[model samples]
Target chain A: MIRIEDLDFSYGRDGFRLTVPKLEVAAGEKVAWIGPSGSGKTTLLNLTAGIVSPDHGRIVVSGEELSALGDARRRDFRVRRIGMVFQEFELLDYLDVLDNILLPYRINDSLTLGPEVIERARALAEGVEIGDKLHRDVQKLSRGEQQRVALCRAVLTGPDVILADEPTGNLDPSNKERVLDILFRYADEHEATLVMVTHDRDLLPRFERVLDFDELCTPAPAPAQEARA
Target chain B: MSDSLYLAWRYMRHHKLKTAILIGSVTLILYLPLALQVLVDRATEQLSARARSTPLIVGARGSAVELALSTLYFESRSPAPIRMAEVERIRATGLAAPIPMHVRFRVRNQRIVGTTLDYFDFRGLRVGRGRPLAKLGECVLGAAAAAALQAGPGDRVNSSSEALFDLAGVYPLRMRVVGVLERTHGPDDEAVFVDIKTAWIIEGLGHGHQDLASVGAEGRVLERKDGRIVANASVVQYTEITAENEDSFHFHGDRSGFPLTAILALPPDDKSKTLLLGRYLGRDETSQVLEPVAVMEELVGTVARVRSWVIAAVVLVTLATALTMVLVFWLSLRLRRRELETMARIGCSRRTVASLVVCEIAVVFAFSVVLAGALTGVTSLYGPSLIRGLIL
Candidate 1:
């Protein structure tokens, strides 16, 4: 389970602010964050990923308190236990798709890579229909293909929680549904928590629960905090 | 290759043009000082060895440096000729082995050095082909001289004229190449060795002539007058000396005034050297004696001072070039910031990312060092021959 308590975050005093009193996500829950632009949905996702710590809050993912760890330890924890997919599909241009998918294991010494891990990476490429382009430069791939590579990298390590910020924001309707199916199936098979931020309301029906960021000014009946999933 | 190096090499391959330009520039910059130092050291070795072996020189009063250069390397032109009397006078001192040198002419643009067999022994020269100088007009060629003329034993070489318009100029003489000497890697290796008498023959002081006055009205030979032996309009001087006319070759002047360009004096000990130097110390206008080691020391010392400035300039240029390289590398890293950020997001520690970047730079530096070393190796191998060809 992932938990958040009394989180208060802001860009600056003059910028946008986010506040949450309490929230908890079950170990295998599928939660979606939906809101309009400037809703701090991506900021909230970044907080969960340990990319940005809150001004006043404590977060616990997989029962590990993130606020207690130092910066380096937090980064270590992020690389070892959590996987994040960026909105921009931040693929390293110098590396090919296969290397990009294997990047996490390359950097994190705590992760032991074996023949089975290599085979799983190859299988992930095949499943995403980028098997032929595994050695191709990532920048040369189409937007949809690059997006698939990013999704493959996110789940390649089979992390405890997958925090995806606008995972299918730039995909067409057909690619959007296909990529969503892949992400959901990967999460369900691993029994991992999935927290996805999306502007598309059409994908909301598939989630077990959805949080609306526009309701920040009101005290609602739903959960007040968005946790790991 | 280590994992970091593998990644560094792959990145370098990805940017092949950049890598090559950097390495090429570095190699060229590095090669400058290395090549200069090697060639200078080699030339210095050659110069000092010859100078140290030839201890003292005696010539008509003039530049001591030029006289030392003349006798030590045989490069002096129009060196005021000292007489054989002066050479004998010095040899009588019982303090030296005075070898007379008369090298005022060239055969096929290579110096024709006229001296005794002691020159060979003094310079540690040995016969490599055929035999040593055994008779007048019989020549032994140095290694480079033989290579230049492409003439060996049984072949012939002709001396070149020093003056073209002088009506009384000495006729060029044909010399039989009797031997070739082993390479000494010194100035002697580029010289043609001949007996001192052969040089006087080229100077017209001695010549082979016909008995023109002896041809009587009845076409019979007759005893010649003392004045008739002198070369005149009627006497036909043979341009060459051979066994058939070898008896006719004679000198018309006294032995006291025989032409000798310079005398190489090798002292047996320091006391002899001091005695010779003391004899020539007060005689300024008549002649001067010089130590080649001292002369060459002064010359190379001056050159080495200038070389220090050159080395300083090379160092400054290298520093500037290296600074520019660092700036270019820093700018390239700035351009790759997003790439580094991507690596960071992918669980690369900041230190690991820095290592990746530094590893790429180190690879370029290491490869360039190797390239510079390779270039130096090739230049060191071939540079001596080029320098010898130019100056020997």
Candidate 2:
């Protein structure tokens, strides 16, 4: 469940600006954001994950306001309640697939990792067809395999919301279909909401809600007034 | 440890070459000072211990350090050889027991030390195998000397020739090895022990000639021949001393005037040590009676100055190494900036990434310290032998 209202975010002097008066995704809903390149699709996901705070907005992620928490608390919240899949897969090469999947627990002490969690991780890797590569370094894996590993890591924490940026960008057609099946199936089973960014239009029919970023973005805002001495 | 440190360890293990090279740099940087300090301390301790045992050395007037070096270490010979008469006079006082030393020749790079049996007893030298020198030509090998020569009790070594062209210079004495001294871990370990008369024989002060009855024994005797019963071409000089020839080994000069390199004195008590020191204190021209320990302290003082220079050199090397290490590691971290950003983006705090880098450095430092400690232990074990090789 992610809620955004009056979200006004900007990047740089000559960067994309985003505006959303009101946007809400219900629990367990499969939503897709379809837009052109630099249309603020991944930026919206980053804002929702509290990676970068919005300039003028109120964002509620899993019933917690992003503006209410400090920077560290926001990071901890993201680690605990939301899982993100980057477009580049963002896997640490030194660690194997299992450790990358279990990274959330390693960083945040609030999440306890015990034998049951380890078993769940194995099960999740099995679902993603990477069970045999649990101990193999992610750098040795192909792009498709890395994509699957990133998806498994996103859902390994059983977070309330999953945010994916170009999750199926590098997969073949058939592999992409299978990946969507697994992702939606796992999210439905866990009753977690999903928000994915994609450039493909054919993949838009599967999501219950398809939000087009062309309707949500505006022209670049003027630069802020210089701070007086 | 946190997961950040665990990740750091994994990265280091994954990059074995990088880790090994960094650890090697740190280990070498740390080993220099540790090695110098350890070696210097061990040398000081050993020099002081040897000095303690040899309480006094009576030698020709010269540099005290030179006297200490020559007498205690059996290194360079004294510039002016003192007469053995001084040993007799020192003994007549009853204030001390003097052990005469004659070191004038070498056998296979091993110093041939000609001293009395009392020298062995006074120095606490024990034969690990065979017997002590009991005959004129019998010799005892120190542990290292025996090892260097690879000779046992039954073997023999010829004293080195001094003048290769001189036909009548002291002939090489074929001395039989009767025993091998136990490892004393001192200068004795590098010397060959024989009777003082044997040294005189090696010095040409004493010699052996064919007997009058052996003038024509198997035509093997060759010597100078003329007049009534004079030595001739038939009379021969015996190079190897046997039971028959050892009886003829006698000093020909005024025996008291025979040369000795040093006289090691063992005073009975503090009062005797004082009396012996006072007896020869003002008479610095003929001989110098020196407390070996005091002279060694002066020697150590000079060595301490050299050590300070070594320490300064060590500091400069350490700083240069540290600077290179810092530059290399800082550049390495910069190259890993993207990886660190990935870690931060994965919900790890920036502090965690910084801590990871620091933990990696700490691990390398810990490894270097342990490596340096092990190196120090090995050097300490071999310290005395190293000193003997370098100084003696």
Best by lDDT: 2
Give TM-scores of the second chain, every candidate.
0.83, 0.89
The local distance difference test score of each candidate is 0.80, 0.83
Model 2, runs deviating above 4 Å: A11-17, A172-174, A219-229, B155-158, B162-174, B207-212, B218-252, B278-284, B387-392
Please report, as a residue range, the 10-residue window in candidate 2 chain B with the lowest summed lDDT: B221-230
lDDT of 2 by residue, B80-104 (tens): 7999999999999999999998887
The segments of candidate 1 whose C-alpha lies over 4 angstroms from its true place after superposition are: A11-16, A20-37, A87-98, A112-120, A126-152, A166-182, A197-212, A216-229, B24-42, B73-80, B102-114, B127-261, B374-392
True contacts kept of each: 0.34, 0.46
A1-229 in candidate 1: lDDT tens per residue? Answer: 6788888877655556778777778888899888766667777777777777888888899989886777677777888778788767888776789888887776655566678887899999999899989899998998889988998888988888988888888888888888889888888899989988888899999999888877642222223353221
DockQ of each: 0.34, 0.50
| lDDT tens per residue, model 2, A17-92 | 7788889999899999887665667778888988888889899988999866787888778877787887788887
Listed in order, each prediction's TM-score against the native is 0.78, 0.89
